[model samples]
Target: MKPDTSTIDIRAMALLIILCASWGLNQVAIKAAVADIPPVLQAGIRSMGATCLMLVWMTIKKKSLLEKDGTLLWGLICGLLFSAEFVLIYWGLEFTNASRSTIFLNTSPFVVALGAHLFIRAEYLSRIQIIGMVLAFAGILVAFHESLNLPDSGMIKGDIMLMGAAVFWGATTVVIKASPLAKVYPGKVLLYQLGVSAVILPVASIFLGEPPVQALTPLVISSLIYQTVWVAFFTYVTWFWLIRTYPVSRLAPFTFLTPLFGVLAGSWLLGETVTIYLLCALAMVGAGIYLVNRR
Candidate 1:
């Protein structure tokens, strides 16, 4: 593992951009594919497929999934949180545009930061961090301002669901960081979540009465491949590697680019309207994320 450093070289920056773009495009792919495969079912399939791929990679690298000492309990907790987060994300996408959902989903950092501050003594928040949190919340309000004015909107429901997803995502992070799972290899930690989610999400889909696949078009197949290979497997591994090699504070601010890419990709691929309000809100959220991650 590379020693943590404040400097982000050109290569690292380029890789970060690629990672963000891949993640941003993932939302668009999910939105397009969910029409054919019910969102929950689609998520389950992707998780299972990714788990298989992860197993192969781990085998090739001679990494032991069982190396984590006493992590089973925390691993299961993280897995459940991961499963819940994706369920809400996929379900929320069914009711709202990808751009809007992506914006709300990015709020996970704010949630994670807050949780860390409250639970981890080492992560106590400074005044600037508090201000960043307030700004982030303000941005969320701005993004949903119109929807809030109109009662009982599908967009409102979708936004709320996405927010719920962000909460779960943040909670998962806290669990991993606070528990014995943090002592394990990143791949092992990921395997626990992927392996457990593979089972949980499918069962949840069945219980939720998600319908069978409507059709398996080329686009749907391609989206599934992308989600399984690129988004869930490769990018995740790359992200873990990057964080291990660099200062997380340096790498984290670049994540704000993800929602920007998400918004642009949604407009380009799905023809979602980019309202002025959304742009203003994105700016606020981006600034807040930068502040929160700043040293």
Candidate 2:
């Protein structure tokens, strides 16, 4: 039997960077639509739509959607965590700016690093790698220095929610890494998340009294398409493949770069300001990614 990959190679690195960029831009899309659709409902819509697309694609590919894999339990857990992450993120954005959201949301890697060290065999982090994770997070703070100081009264609550989402995000990755889901088809793994969230988010949205859709403007429509097609479906499929094919600990830290890309995408797409902090933060993030991946 082939041993699992223990490091990030060139192709995985490139794919991770692309996933980060896609995720960064996805945040802006979420923010763009939240004003028109209630946050939880919007997430529900994204998941619901992505689930449809995945269903069709898997059908075309003749992939089994309901195979009796031993991964059922873990898959459901991942879905719940995935649902929670989205619910927290969109709901939190209602109370916080994207800058602060990025800062808190990207803390997921620390959870992955710690969890993988304890549970996953042969995935321990050296001291330098731990520093790399911290450095990458520091880059996120620097990237959003202004947002960190924003004086919104609800900012604390929003930040706490975002932090909770990060934990769920990390825990989901660790669960997949340590469970039977790691050995399943990537599309199936993503289906677990998309499918479960598909049901849960919408039901919760109803319980929360969130409107299914408020405005349905072009921006909202485009945002939903971007999220469902690209972020939720494509990139997530790639993300699952990556975690299964490589070390989850090595892959998770690159998410630290997501908010940096979010900041830049915000500047390009939303006219948010850019500053010297981004450049310095980029350098630190680069260094951090390197240190963690060092042989």
Candidate topping TM-score: 2
- Clashing residue pairs in candidate 1, if any? none
Instruction: State candidate 2's TM-score.
Output: 0.92
Residues 60-168, model 1: lDDT tens digits = 9898776638988888888889998988887787688665775678677666666766764455557886676667556656655654444358888988999899889
Winning model by lDDT: 2
**Cα-lDDT of candidate 1:** 0.76
The reply for model 2, stretches above 4 Å from the true place, is: 1-4, 94-97, 149-154
Estimate, for each residue in 259-290, the C-alpha lDDT of model 2 and write its tens digit: 88887898999999878999999999999999
